[model samples]
Every structure is written in C-alpha cells, then in structure tokens.
Target: MLARNLPASQTTEKVVENCPIVMGFDLKYARAGFTVMQSVLETTPDAQFCAFNVLHDGLPDFAQRLGHLLFDGPRSSITFIDVRPHFDHLELFETRHLSRAMYYRLLIPILFRNAQAVIYLDSDMVCRRNIFAMVDALPPGACLGAVRDNISRGDRARGAMMRDVMDHGPEDMLELSLADYKRDVVGLDNPDRYFNSGMVFFRPSEITDSDVQACFDLCHAPRYCPDQDILNTIFGDRTHLLPERWNYVLTFPETVGLIPDDWMRHHREEEEHAAILHWPGPRKPWRDPSVPQAEVFLEMGRRLDERLQEVAPEFFKDVLPAS
Candidate 1:
C-alpha cells in the first residue's frame, strides 16, 4: 500500500464555518426524489443546504417542476445546471449515475471555488439529524469524513453482486479479493476504511488541490464504483471517522447490541435529527417493498411524494408503487 504524509494539525484546522454547504443530486427518473431531500434542508434552520440536478440538457419542464416543489422560497437554494460543457468526457459520467458523478466533478469544484465546506449526499438518503452539526464534527483540514462500511458483510455482498451481474468466475472473484479488492481493488483497506459513498464531507481545498483528480484518475483506469472507490483512495487516511449516529446504514442486525431501540425509533420518527438515514442497499423505499424498514420508509416516501405532486403536478407523476 502507498502512504503519503500530510501536515497533522493542518488537516485538523477548520476552514469553513460550523455550517456545512449540504448538497445532493437526482437523475430525472427518480421522480420528485431530490425535492424530498431539499424539504429537510428547508426545514433545518441551522444549516445552509442546497439541492440540485445535472441534466443532459437543461430541461425546462424539469426546471418548472423543481420550481413548484420548492415554491416555498428554498428554490433559491436549489439549482438545476447542465454539466455537458463543464465536463466533456463521457467516461466520467458513466459510473453509479451521472447525478452522483456530477456531484463530485462539478459541484466539488464549485464548492472549492466558493471557499466553502460541504457534505455531498446521495438522493436516496433521508435527513434525520442536524446536518450542520455533523459537518462541524470534522477535524479542521480533514479532507473527508464518513462512517465505515461493514466490510465483512460488504465483501460477501459485493462478491455476490459481481457474480450475479458479470458472471465472474470463482477464481476471478478470489483473485479480486486477494488483490485486496476490499482495499486496493476497492480503493482502501477494510476495517479502518471502506465507507459507503452515500454520504461524504470535505473542504474545497481537497478537491481543488488535485486530490479529487487523483481519485478520478484511479477510478477511470479500472472502472469501479466511481464515488466510493475514488473517495477511499483519496481520503484514505485523512477522513474523519464520524460516529454511526450521522450516516447510519440499516444493515446492523438487532443483535449487534449497538444503537438503542428507543433511539432507532426516534431516528425513524425523524425525532433525533440523525443527519441522514442511508438505505445503502438495493431495497430503496420506493423501489423495494420488502425491506425490513419498508413501512416507515414507505410512509415517508409517500407523504413526500404527495407533497411534491400537489406542488409540481406535471413533474412528479405518482411514484411507482415499490416496484
């Protein structure tokens, strides 16, 4: 493994204010998706939040839909931009989803240029905590911060996914593991590292100073999950390991003896303000109905969906019932 030394205290120096410039993006098909995320920000009085989407072209219809959804004045905080000119490479837009790539490639730069610090989240996440406070927790100059992924479980899942999707041979899968797939192949070592890309935060300097570019270059070469792999590689050591309270994934079994039941209920009820709830697996609220957290997630999804439709009727057709 390659290691680089950086200034210890410099990485801990706070550059941005306590508030974070929150961001998330949605592809057009997600259906009023980003709007629900924006609602949390609008309701949050402490943090300065912004939601956006990067379209192939600036579709007027979608813009109108966004306007209606955010008619309550937070529209000023939301943006719909075209990234075609800003990022000319098609390969850069190929992984995960373009909306996600755009979040990193385009928005990260803009954040740096603005001299702001922000946490970039995926649209699938639900905000349950005070986001700004979560950002404030990062040590100053820390290039990135995120919760660690459950590696033992993630490796089994990733292996199965590759076998199911790519028909990879057992040997190929084994080789990937031997090559430190969970580490080098995946961009960082397991246990101490390997975080889900659903949530990440960093200062603008990290991206502006070639760190982001370094991650991008490594990702494009092998064609991996662009966001997670790139982030793991770039902020390997610099990332602050925040408590599970912030970006809690619903994978830990009840037997883990961790999060208290009452707190789980509070987070589910949006009472604790848990920064974000990441349905980090395939069982998304609107798409997968059998998820153990289905009922709670569905209720939230439906209410938000209805709210969006009432305001932006044309843009948000009924979200397809948990396909």
Candidate 2:
C-alpha cells in the first residue's frame, strides 16, 4: 500500500530486513534521539532500530555512526531514512514542544507494508526495558497500542468546572464550549479512548493509505498540539491502551501540582522505575537539567559521548556532556 502522504525520496543505509522499531525527529533533536538510542542499546540490545530523520544542516553525523555499531551480531543496528521532502512542502502546525517530525509515524504502513507491526517512539524518551514484549500481547484486530495520557483521560471524567487543562484536550477549545470542543474538535466523548503518541505499536495491515492521508490532511489546521490531535482523531477508537509504564510521561512529581493526586492513584508506578521515561514539555534535560528526570537522560548522554568518542573520535570529541 503506497501511502499518499509518505515520503518518496529517502537516503537509505541498510534498512532492517523485518518490521523495524522506528523513531522520527528533525535535526534539532538528533542529540535527543541519540540519547534514546543509547538507552535502547543498553537495555533492549537486540531490537531492530530505525530512524526516519528529517535532515537539516546536513546529516546527523554521530547518530548515523552509532546506528552502524555492531555489538552482538546486529544487536543494535540504526538505519536512517531521509524524510525531509515529504513534509517540507506543508505548512503544518508547530511550536517549541511539537516538531513536524512528530507527524512522521503515520508513514509506517507505507514504509513497511508487508510487516505485521512496527514500533514508533518520540526522540526524547528513555527506554529502560525491552518494550517488544508488550507488543506480543497486543490483541488481534487491534489497530494500534499506546498508553493513555493519564492527565488527558482523567480530565474528561473530572467533575470540577475548573481543572488543569492540556492543550487541544477535553476542555473549552478554540472558542467552543468544553462539551462542544470534545465532541467537535476532538470527535470523542470518552477520553479513555485517547492515547499519547509518544510510543506506539502500529499495525500496518489494520489501516489503509487513507488513514495516512487523514493524518496529513489534519496538518493543514493550526493547533496547540497538532500531531497529537491528528492521531487521536484518526486512530483513537480502535486503540488498545497499553500499560502506563511503556510511556510513563514522568510529569507527576517533577513539576509539582501539574498532576492531580487522583491521577497519580490511577497510575501507581513511579517515573524512574518505568519502562520508558518520557520527558514531555519544553524543558528537556539537555536544555534544562533541573527537571526531575533530567539525570536519566543526562547520564546516558554523558556515556553516549564516551561511546562515540571510542568509535569515532574526531567528530564527537567532548560533545554530549551532561547538562
């Protein structure tokens, strides 16, 4: 199935033979993506890793080199596909937190048509466990699997008139009443149906090229959280909500009072112990080291710098230091 919105021009350097575990990001987050790759190499060393990178200011030199590092017989291979031309033409919504790269996961079906499934991840996440095990448990006929954005889910069920609101979520939005917005803009009554797009198990066979087109078409409208809105609108109903540990957004205690106690009760696992520690929001560990989970990313980045130094000295010398 040739996805109409999928990128046709790609520079490939040995893509994986089977369904790949993919991550997409622009050049600005190349370091962040590398940090994620480092964590995966440390924990899930055997996983098939591919990066659908949007290039700017030339190729991501260090990121590409780390992809070729052969540990235990392709224990970790990083394949990169250039995804610039596909999205460059569109004036998609974007902000300090959301990049155009966030929308690239929609291309999974077109990229790997024959594969049963593919894993997609945001660049800023820290992987502590082999999440492939979770995919094995995905129910037959499920189109996609992801953790519910607890903060997003709870707000819909929230009784209080005033509550901490998430952008483009179940609240008064774009001058529409809370009821009308959720029903109209989001096209959902039950917030439980919404899932964070940070990490996803995308089943290519369950969807079609039009689903991919729908996602791209949504990009025309500007919103606070563009890619997320597109995803929830297109794929929410058929989604299988996974265990929270897979995405563990890591916002509970870090930014105090951001997450309500009741929400915490629903998701009991602590952030540090979770499978994938994802630090959303603008203050990333690299930019602002004071964030709660910053150390997890910083320490690994320090080590990643060392690993790169060992592999290719001239390019990565004294880079990737802890913030």
Candidate 3:
C-alpha cells in the first residue's frame, strides 16, 4: 500500500508473488522510521509494503509533518497507518506505558487483516539483502524468523553482564546465553532457530487470539528484555533464524579500521546494502557529534526528523558533548 498523501506526478503499484507480503514498523524510532520509508519508496513500488506507527496521537500538525517526510517521495505510493484507534484488543496496556512487549500487539491486528505472514523490524536497523528471502524461509505454523547475533564475543567475556542480565550462574550462563543455541535452540532437530529479535518474521495465525495480550501481561512479571522474553515465550520453537546479512548492526565506526577516515565511506556502503541498519547503542550518530562517522547518520536524521534540533539538537550541533 502507498502513502495516503503524495505528489500528483508520482505513481506506485503493488506486486504480489509466491511469498507472503511483508510489513514493518518504526514506532518510537521516528528517524529510522522515515529513513526506512524513504528507502522502501526508492526501491520497491512494485513490491507490496506497509508502514506502522503506533504512537501517532492524530494531532493535525504531527500527522502533516509525518506525511510530508514519509509519503511525499519522488515516486510515492506508500501508505502510513496509525493503529492507535484499534487499541481495544489490548487496552489494558495504554500506549503511554507500552513496553516493548506491548508495543508488538498492534501489529497482530494489522497482520491478521493484511497477510498471513509479516516481518517486523526495529527502526535502528538497516537492511542489506532483500527481506523477501528471509520471509520465504519460514516453515508453516511458524510465527517468527531472524538471524543469530553476529558476534557472540564469547561467553566468559560476556559473563559478568549476561549473568546479571539473565540472573543465571556461571554454569547456566551457557544455557542462558544460548551460546550453543545457534547449534541447539530448535531442539537440534531443525538447525535454524537462534535468530536475533532485531529482525523477525511472524505469522499471526500461529499466535493465539489471546496470546498477544498474554505476552504483554507477562512483561510486568519478570524480565531482562521484555520484548525478547515475550517472543521467546510466545513463538518459541516456531521461530527460525535467517542469515546475518539481512540486518547488520553497523558497529561503531572505529572498529572497521576507518575510524576517522573511513567513517563516511563505510556508512554509505552500509546504507546502500541495508534493508535496515540497527543502531543498537546509545551512541547514535545523529546525537553524538564526536563520532567520526557522524555526518552520514546526521544527514539521515535531517531527512527523517522534522524538528531535528528540537528533538535532539545535540545531534546537529557543531560541538561535541562535554565529557
């Protein structure tokens, strides 16, 4: 579907094939959301796509700004929908306090209405390979698919934090880490199970009508990462991991040997390949002026955010943050 508002000269079409159509959202991550919308608008007018934003409060000014950024592309045919109106199914979790787990509930209703299967991605990510390949690999009755974390960094090194995060002992660290999961999460019967939730494909039919809400309720109980835990609880064995290239988290620019010099070059290369680029840490290229590769991400933010300075001026400010 295309955006509701677009320039008169622009036109777009929907093309469907053997695979299930794909859907994704960029909720709180508005910058990445707009970038994703632009990326999709650039490449895939013929391919079926949908954009979700749960936080839209229906304010005219907010809606107008979002529409201008997302839908007014050169070849625009993108549909941006606000799912806030249909909050009835999971009203127990208000949008304001919506945890990452509860945040996923609105998608189920959208998925149920559109296609049997859909892949949801976090806004911080950039996509390299075609996402259709990832969606094609899921088996029937499965609700999710993803790639394993690219770097394990080894168990012992991650032990201190992982132990505290999972509340497990040294012995259980391996199990908790699922350091072996890439080898065993799917019972060792099917090898494709240890994907990172940063990128995932899900089939709503596989999720019980009540399961989405149940997962949200589970969030208040106990958790390290609410989203991951809810997904692990709900989808479990049905989830599969795709290859890593689909959602490469562009690591801090320093590690790539470019440091000060190659930052922009690497950032450009990543942007070209990525279906989505997941900027996982707090050192956002937009907000951190000190980062060597800050320019590209900063430019990206300028395009995505209507009020870049107001929302995060430190992002565009010439001076770096004080230590």
- Which is the leading candidate under lDDT? 2
Per-residue CA lDDT of model 2 for 274-322, tens digit only, reads 7777877666778887876677777777877777777767866334333
Q: Candidate 3 residues 2-120, lDDT tens each?
A: 12122221134334342332333433445555555544443444344444333333324453355454564443433444555544454332223233333554355344544566556
Write the residue-wise lDDT of candidate 1 on 261-283 in tens digits.
Answer: 55445435542334456665455
Show model 3 residue runs off by greater than 4 Å. 1-14, 17-28, 45-65, 72-102, 105-113, 150-157, 161-194, 252-275, 289-323
Model 2 lDDT, full chain set: 0.64
Better of 2 and 3 by TM-score: 2
List lDDT for all candidates, in order. 0.51, 0.64, 0.46
Q: Of models 1 and 3, which has the larger TM-score?
A: 1
- TM-scores, all candidates, are 0.69, 0.78, 0.59
Rank the models by TM-score, top first. 2, 1, 3
Give RMSD (Å) of candidate 1 vs. truth. 9.2
Pairing residues by index, what is the TM-score of model 2?
A: 0.78
